[model samples]
Target: MKQTSFTEDQLTDALRALKADTSDERFRLLTSEPPKARIRPLLWYGVAASVAMLIVAASIWQSSWSIHPDTTPTATTATVDENLSQLVGQSIAAQTQAQQQRTLTNDIVSEHLSLVEP
Candidate 1:
């Protein structure tokens, strides 16, 4: 028997099409059946949700701006200038130390090369 196998996507698409056709017929059928969903309750739910979200957003914004303790420039200008000068001095010292270390290493490498060549 030559059995035909369908892929998952093909089966899902077939089921989806069937469901759509049946739903369309059901909606078109004019019977005394209760409605599936009421529009008025859903509309009210959406309005209530929108109002709650607006209130929450407004409170968040107002709270964020309120009681802002001047967090910036906590350090005085005198201390900042002192710290800047100190940093500059430390940077200069570090460069001088690095140059001296490089000079020493170069001299040692050249001495080793000379011995190796001879």
Candidate 2:
């Protein structure tokens, strides 16, 4: 192999060029900027826990509203029922009166026909 030699001045100029290329302002700025903030695992866990708690609370509230226990009958309800029964009784009495009147008219007509035939 032939021996290759670099002169002292040539080696220094090459090193200077390499140093200048490596020290670019754009590369320095990119490296110097602070790193972006990252979300923590604990924060995600807390959010999940809060959502679960809210769901549980909502379910409990809904169930409590839906399941109603029977209470004592109110006076207003009793009075309404009483009025309804009275109206039904009045309707039945009116029907009975109408039926009796029809029966009386039929009897009178039959009696008149018998007298005329005899």
**Alpha-carbon runs more than 4 Å astray in model 2:** 1-75
Evaluate residue 108 in candidate 1 and report its C-alpha lDDT on the 0 to 100 scale. Answer: 100
What clash count goes with each model? 0, 0
Candidate 2 per-residue lDDT, tens place, 53-91, comes to: 999999997776567545333436678799899999999
Q: Go through the candidates in order and give each one's C-alpha lDDT.
A: 0.80, 0.79
Worst 10 residues of 1 by lDDT: 65-74
Off by over 4 Å in 1: 1-73
